[model samples]
Target chain A: MRRALILSLALIPALLSFAIAYLFQRGAIADFVWSGTYQIDAAGLFSRAGLAGSALIAFILLTFWWAEGRAEDTFQAERNMQEETRRRFFRRLDHELKNPLTIIKLGIANMRHTPEISSQQQASLDRIGQQAGRLQKLVEDMRWLSELEAPRLEQAPVSLAEILADAVALARAAYPDRAIDLAVQQAPWPLADISGDRDMLVVVFRNLLDNALKYSTPGDKVAVRAADDGQWAAVEVADTGIGIPDADQPSVFEELYRGSNVQAIAGSGLGLALAWRIIKLHKGSIRLRSRQGQGTVVTVRLKLPAPRD
Target chain B: MSKPTLLVVDDEADLLAELKPLLERSGFAVATAPDGRRALDSLQHLTPDLIILDVLMPHMDGRELLRRLRKAGNWTPVILLTQVGTPAERAMSLQEGADDYLNKPFDPIELIARIEAVLRRTRRGDAPLSSFRRLRSGQLSIDRQTRQAKLDDDAFSLTARAFAVLEHLMLNPGEIVTRQRLLDEVWGWEHAVETRAVDIRISEIRKALSAYQPGCIETIVGTGYRFIHEVVGHA
Candidate 1:
């Protein structure tokens, strides 16, 4: 419908020229007796008018192009501004909501500790505490997402052994019931030292291990191994559990994305997202290999720091 | 067990009302303050075992209150209740003197745990010997007998509170000490107060320690302060 309007507008100049040319042609074609009074050349007049009409068409097209370009820029800028404003708004909203929730959490906790609160109320409070824990994790995930855009990766001489130990400690704390088998070669590998944030790397490993434990069946073994491939260091987390389906592997790293097998799991779908972000920040790559029934292996490769001259 | 004493400071009446009965029933002797000024006024006579302090308040925010408290030799364990906007400040509060810091809208259960932890540290004792015994890292000397800090032969003069913080850090060495722990141990801040009281005192400790030895204390940006220098074994 709008295209028709533009086409009609473009034809106006041509139609006006045609009408004037028809009048000039009528006089020009008159007999010799009327030649002196009607000296107009129809073709010449129409040609001259056509040139002006062409120029008008060109001007119209140029104006259209310029307006469309400006409109696109304005639209994009407006969209960007809207997104930034939305992010800020959500961040503030998260903060505002956190306070009252905290007070409630504190109140519930205090109530639970009291001998006066009934056993049933304590149970209810326990549920509230669990939900609050979930809420806190959600808030943390949001904060992590915001930071992931340009997450700071501090580089310092870090002991890989120390980091792995910490990750193991965290895993033990996270799943005290789960049995984890860890095998280290008789001699500790003199791994290459890399300048990266140890805490972020810890999160990455912890998440990987946590995912392994979450997906694994009882009595299944979760194994962690590390090796140096000369140029990069490779750390693999392998678990004998319900593996990720082939179809869901691609989108696993996407933010807030969870696998089809994750429906029954208790998670915010942020573990891998955070892990991906942390690895990327450290200029590393993470890959997953899994089959529907077979176990899954997640391997992360990070560049080894260059030796100082 | 006697009810633990907790000082709840905030300008919001509704919040105070909500907190009072909740804490009272939980076996706490609760005191209330509407603002930082009133909080300090209350502090003069009532030394709460733990303080639940708001970061943003009228007539002296939590930070200023902590600064004044440290300057006047009032060391208390404080758990800072902070809003999201003040995260950087919240992190800094640990350095100031907060034993532990929790963001606002926190889970009351977690807050209680933090409060109890600080209270446990306080009950352990206020003496440097007890504080020093809780931490271990390098060969750093904190002479509680003379209230002197020495890095080998270098003499460092620290305020009583500053010395307390140093002692606390020396004990932990490489471990993270939240601002709340410092406030609870050094300043005797009873409740979890704002994190800034920690920031100011840490800055003071840093200045004094660095005067004797460069880069003696390392500021762990989002966590509490730690003494970074490796303690060399005495010959």
Candidate 2:
């Protein structure tokens, strides 16, 4: 529609100039015929001029069409090449790291069984194992992100409230001793379910809730609030933890980006990025609002399932 | 009885070196193969109780070997090892007749647990049934097609709610299934059911289950119910 409008707008000047030229040519031709210098018919001259104008206009349009098609072709090719490169890179990373990491982990497990190792050596071994686990998690995160770039969602009717509850349950099970006061509320009880991949939706909320719990210390307050409009559902995951700095807030949803203020916290830094990717895949919007020392609230807005869809 | 022998196939010599002693110490006679071709050659002359197949290899990959094994009527229990195991991969591995699967760089502890669970299951005069359409633990089994819970030779009729609650519990064996989770899962979230309602269905299932196996599902006081058995899944 925009292109058509632009095309019409572009023709206005051409049409005006052609009209002016045609009128001028008609006047000249009439004078020539009256003086009998050229002996040209006015109607014949007008028809010839109109044909030439049409040919010129068609040539210009053809040039524009060719240029647009070439631009799109290169753009598409570049995008596809980039995506293939990413997929190959992740595959190599996964395969290369698996066997050695396995060896390190299994070797650590075996070493601990020996009675000769001192307590200090055991601690170091444990640390090595933890770092290996973190690396494995990072690799998994990268793989999932790459997969998300393609359309891999098993879309279905999924309940946001139920998923929120499940995520809270998982978070609670994972960290039973975080000592954070947690609250969850759903406006008007149960919200209408949205169409999405159940597993992915669960992961998105689970990561959001997990991050909320992970960034907070003991006695911190974390809450989840969700509401349903007529055709959309909005949820807010808020926490009274050390909020992200203004400089880092914008990039928190980028892959592997960690806040400078969160240097002490242990994280893969892909949780929010994963959540952002998922919400975007579901045709939704996610936003983070925070102040330096106060708190952060992440709001997610998603569309409800269409009536006949 | 002699120790069970395991065939561990991978292209990484260093991993095989590290893994062999671990499995040996865990009471298995471990045999190593550098790739799928060697593993298949060994299988022609040797019968290992379990085959640990790696996903990536030089001569052939584990998935192809697995497909060939099943096509040729090799019924030995197989556990797959892979890198960055996704949900789809996990599901596919099980469907391809693998007894179990573990993501690479895993704790040796989980590996052992999976091994034992798989062994115990196959030892129970049962076929490798990770491709489960039915759920079972010992003498009690639930057929999903008929929605019937059978105990030994007797069939106990259960309400749909009870069967769903039981199915969920069986699916997540040894994990706590909270009252709220059961309600949300079984009651469809739209029904405003109390946590007390979960108790009623659990009692009905508990009475029927106790006839064959006592204390099948335990109530964890304040938290939830945990299915107290090594649940085996089958077709």
Candidate 3:
């Protein structure tokens, strides 16, 4: 739409120049043929000038079309290359972080066994162990996101119910006080598993659950419901909390994009982006319908693969 | 009886100085080694009833020394002493023939208890388990119930916990009783306490045996305590 608008605007100046020149040439021809009397030659010259002007305008329009198409192609190519480079950098970073993390785990284990340490010291050490575990999880998230760009989406029959259950369990453990009302319309939901990376699926649910917990006011219900859409599994995580505004909705899934209303909330702003990538990888679509003061409902439809041979 | 001997091996001079006198006061004939090589050298000439081995050291670490000692068939009960032993590291050590482990900056009382228990365990027997009603393994004699123990026909002096510990080993004979099981059976604790507590008691039992029974208890690494059902002469 923007391209068409620019092309029309550019052609307007050319159209005006042709219209003025055609009028001037016609006035000049009026004197040559007969200033006081009309002649057939004057009319002929006027028609020829009009024909010439239309031919020139058509040629200019064709040139503008070619230039606009080339520019768009170049812009798109640059955007894709930039995305690829960013992914490669993150993947390498994740792999590098994991090596030291493994070593730290082994070293900490060795330290914990030394019986000479006091109990107080041991408790402090355990806390450090938990933090390291969290770091390991973050690195895992990075690796999963980088994998999304690969062409062949690795799909396998995954238990949709089990994944939801696990996510609910984690949320409960994280926020035992929160009243999270989970309603499954189809209790065990066709036992129909969607085909996607189980790890990625777990991450998706976790991200949504995390957001739900954060945005949810105390005593508000965060509902999780799933339905088998025959060809796809549609899961919705609806939170009755502060929601995203209309203008910022389109940019929510953009890398590191945080909604203007929720910028003050603590988050890396990467969760939704990563979730979108996983959804995209499964050849699925995720839609968000949120009202600023009302609530937010994130609906994700994951394309399930055919049954195994 | 003479003082039960303890060989504390660590490269740190300050730690050795502070710990040695404390151990001596606790009724242990304390011996010190600055490094693993020196500790082994000292071992060649004299075998202390208990060895408190440091896990980290220059030239030879506590683990490597324990490995070398086991390879040479030296089954002297060792209490692994270090501040950095993880639970897994301690498990690996126990598996690798380390009789027990204690983290560093250790309490003197706990160290004394561990030493006594390990010593008592080592003096049970050097040979595999066999039924012997009036079993005599060198200075030690087992009079099964009446739960009586004697050293060369003299009544063996042992703490009640020490006696119970010794009895458990004698009954099991060659079998290994894990630290957890020992705590349950002997300490009467329904739940497992720190494995180190068992190590401490074992040290105490070993100390008593060193004075009364000599070499009777044998440590089966990584598994549990066992009685070396034979009278193996000292190195």
Q: Name the DockQ score for candidate 3.
A: 0.02
Q: Score each candidate by Cα lDDT.
A: 0.68, 0.76, 0.68
- Ranking the candidates on DockQ from highest down gives 2, 1, 3
lDDT of 2 at A289: 96
Residues B38-157 of candidate 2: C-alpha lDDT, one tens digit per residue: 899999888998999998899899999999999999889998996655546766887798887777766687677667767776786676554678988999998866878888768898
Give the local distance difference test score of model 2: 0.76
Give the winner by lDDT.
2
Q: Over 4 Å off in model 2, which ranges?
A: A1-88, A148-206, A209-225, A238-250, A260-265, A290-295, A306-309, B67-74, B91-97, B120-125, B131-235
Per-residue CA lDDT of model 1 for B1-235, tens digit only, reads 7788899888777678777887676578999998899998888899788888898898889878877887888777777777652334544776577666666655444456567656766686643223222232343466754677765567667655566677767644445677756654553221212355467557777676564554667777876777776432221
**Residue by residue across A94-138, what tens digits does model 3's lDDT show?**
755743564455456556656699988899889888777666556
**Which 10-residue window in model 1 chain B sums to the lowest lDDT?**
B127-136
> Candidate 1: deviation at residue B229, Å?
18
lDDT of 3 at B1: 84
If both were scored by TM-score, which would come out higher, candidate 1 or candidate 3? 1
* Candidate 1 wrongly placed segments (more than 4 Å): A1-90, A113-116, A145-154, A165-190, A219-221, B1-14, B22-53, B56-80, B85-87, B91-102, B105-150, B153-235
Candidate 2 or 3, higher DockQ? 2
Docking verdict class for candidate 2: acceptable
